[model samples]
Target chain A: MNHHAAQSRAAYLFLTPFLALFVVFLIYPLVQSLWLAFQQTHGPSITRYVGLDNFKSIAVDRLFWKAFWNTAVFALASVCIQLPIALGLAMLLNRPDVRGRAFFRLIFFSPALVGLVFVAVLFGLIFEKRTGLLNVTLHAVAGFDPEFPWLQQYVMPALIIAALWLYAGFNMVFFLAALQNVSRDLLEAATVDGAGPLRRFLHVTLPAIRPVGSFLVLLSLIGSFQLFELPYILLGGGGPDNQGLTVVMYLYQAGFDAGDLGYASAIGWTIAILLGGFAVAQRYVSALDER
Target chain B: MTPTLSITPRRTLAKLSAACLTYAMLAASAAIVLTPFAYLLASSLKTGEDFFGSLFLPAGEGVFGVAWGRITSANYTRLISEFDFTNNIVNSVFLASTTSILATLGAAMGGYALAMIRFPGRRFVTNLVLFALIIPAALMLAPSYQLLYFLGLLDTYTGLILPAAAPAFGVFLFRQAFLSSLPPQLLEAGRIDGCGELRLFVSIGLPLVRPMIGAFVLITYLGTWNNFIWPQIVLQSPEKLPLSVAIAQLRGVYSQDYGLLMAGTVISIAPVLVLFLLLQREFIAGLTAGAVKG
Candidate 1:
């Protein structure tokens, strides 16, 4: 009994530092945010109890809907466009015939190391009207418009393109790992049976990598939904016509810029609920796949 | 089934073409990916006048139609002399290293307890960690800021580092690492040999999960180094601000100065890229371990 008591004591002592900070920082904030979501506040101090008004306002708010639309479109583009290129790159790298695979992967993955804010700074110049790298290269190559307004008129596309460059290779790392794990025996058997490359991929490789694919999809979606710093820095605050506004940017504007923490809390909860739906759906899909 | 017969001229030609195509595609993608980085480096070197005068380097009668003399270190020098980026760099290094070390230690200890010890509340704490994982960070932003305000820690590094040091994600990672890599029998033997609990953890448990410690430390350091919003919210004093916030402020003020902005970014990004290159294996392994295995 004494020995057991000593072990328990040691365990509690080990856990104390983490548990103490987690409770104060994580748990308290979580509960407080729940309460704050239903109230109205100026800054963090001045408060008024306006139950559900924030949520209701969000329901009908045009800017919030626009932000929602922009975020959804980004997420859709990420899944559809970016993930395919990532998978393609992974497939190419997974080939036994490919040499210098590591070198190629390092080159592709290097950009992901650059933080989103810095990416914004670099791409901000890259997307400039005349002297920007994109326009200059395009103009030289194909006589493309030198004065194209990427950040202004084509906000979502520009965001998607920037993100594609940043994340496609990062996601490719996951797909490559999955590809390398696909059963070689099954692949060889299909090949011997005269299964062409596309058929072999569709029949043998795709099913094996399905789990990792779903995981990457969810990861990309969650990340896309949380987009802020890229557009916030690149477009310099929602671009020309609030076209680059994201949910988190809107939340930051509400809380810090506008000094309405209450409405910000509401926006945060809305995002939480939406992301929760994604998680649950992901679980459901995985469960179905298991069955 | 017959390797010799499979080596026909048409088959060889087809395979060669396929290989060529693969190389061609990969090379194209690699060039596209590297263009911005090359542009960034080139842009940082150019003078303001030369920046607009040419795309990459100022075109002239020097080697390969490029004016070698036009490339200047003035932007970099100005950053150090005019703008105190050195201070921001120091702040970034301090915050990142301090937060990573503290967070790693706390996580390893917490993981050791939850994974190896048969305490009464282990299940409760484990459940709490899981619940905490799904809670969107955005939800807590307003409340965490308010909490800091009430505690009078708003502008302090403690306000920033303390909260981050206890990330549920780190604890969960270490727990998984300990559960898989650490054996209960070893700990029991250490206990039987009269080794103190803390000593056992320090010497035995930590060694067993050294890779996790390294990986977790790197992840936390990279995260803290790159993090903007939290520190931007917490710290008000200019001297206390880290690189991420500092760079953003620089952009705000010198948005038009392309050379200066590029130089600042190059400085901000180079260290992490070099670190990632050195620790690429451990970093990639740690990044994908949870996703792949779980």
Candidate 2:
């Protein structure tokens, strides 16, 4: 055999274990999920082939719609509000004038060390209406009464706040790492050309980190959709009035809680499609932003 | 720039205030980040009564007096004794450690094939890995559950560990690292010296790729350690559930005691937190491998 052919054989031999596992666990499951989406499942087995019924049902399903809306809102907040704050703080830390950069970086990155489950549980206590730390502090410091409905009337805001606290640090670290690579000479050139700090930031620094910036946007978008466990644990059965009920929560309900595996598979496919579109749009926008 | 920096009173004042503002912002952000954890510690230490009656757990019976008094480990003891948290912690450690080690090793092998060893269909295989990475785990939940069920792996560590044991992210990162960094001359030298493929991979390639292994292990361990929903679905027996699922059950009206709940939360995250603190740089690099140069 030629060297290239022999090498290919050796490569295949080396790849056997990974390929086997990946095929059995990841690829096969994904294909099976797609197939499952097309059939009506009673418990675990398929009862009938549902051509377009599952997709059609989701279009009219109010709870499903609500979950989608909630997921969208949370995602927007993550992309728009939380990520910007993280980026701005990262910029501040990246500034040479700042003292104790390592110290500040460690402090900012601390929250991310704790897992999401812990954050959810901690926030359950923190956002509690009565005898909660937030309310007590507000009442003491600002003389505001602790009557705000967090878990009930304002579940989205509450969930968003908790999530922001948990994940803002992770994104901040990402931005910080990106910013560390940004060529200082570019910023200096912008400055020498008479751009002020904000102007230099807008023109030079922003463009320099655009790749990481858009990457963060994409990360936030995908992370926002995978929202579960936190809200599920915090709110307990989708919170009051199902306001905190997220897309994954709805998927979980469909498959396990309600035992409608077919509908659950449909929801999963819908999310994959939605995420693909957002990712494409985000890529386009970022490409345009680069110019 | 220096000509513009004439130290006028206004310019000096502006610069000073900007510095102050920057420090103020950093401090505020740190406070916001730290409060949850501080409360976690405080709540974990408080007696169940104190936890219920007080907002800040260590407050010495009055708001202003807020000095530490009567902090206890009773909650931790109770969590271990009552809910079998020890078993779950062991389960979590096992699941996270096994998956991380296996995933890293598997990715190393696959990445070596794709990057070091020349192969046909390599492009197609790499594309498949990217596709796998893009498909979120939530979307795979139902089918994965059914697959595990059919394989008779449900309620077993194999179910939890096997799915994530050959993760696509690991494969991608290891491939990129090896392809970009590994010297082909070294591989050729090893081959010329009559090292067989397996021996060459172990003696030469694996050692040179320590950082990639570190990255993969950190990322995979962090992910699997914090896994909740997937493990919850598969793990039916309460004793077999990882701390993620066990701690989650401690939420809501089921939360008979805040101290116990917080204690469970503490135990759930303690190992990962310690790991993160020690491997902070590696953790960040592992997470941001594709995005950043480091």
State fnat for each of the candidate structures. Answer: 0.66, 0.68
Local error of candidate 1 at residue A43 (angstroms): 1.2
- All candidates: TM-score: 0.96, 0.93
Q: What is the DockQ of each candidate?
A: 0.58, 0.55
User: Model 2: per-residue lDDT, tens digit, B1-294?
Assistant: 364457889888988999999999889888878887888888888885667666655566555677455678998888878777789889888888888888888888898888888677988897787666667767888888888978999888888888787777777777777776789998899878877778878888888778778867888888888878888898898878888887887675566477778888888777887887788776677677667662
lDDT of 2 by residue, A1-291 (tens): 565676788889878879998999988988988888887777765457888899999888999889999999999999988898899889889877898987788778777767778788888888777588887788888987787778878899888888888778789988998888888888777777888878987888788788778878877878888899888888777888888888999999999887778789999999878667446644543343233
How many Å off is the CA of B145 in candidate 2?
Answer: 1.2
Reference-based TM-score, model 2: 0.93
DockQ score of candidate 2?
Answer: 0.55
lDDT computed for candidate 2: 0.81
Query: Which ten residues in a row are the worst by lDDT in model 2 chain A?
Result: A282-291
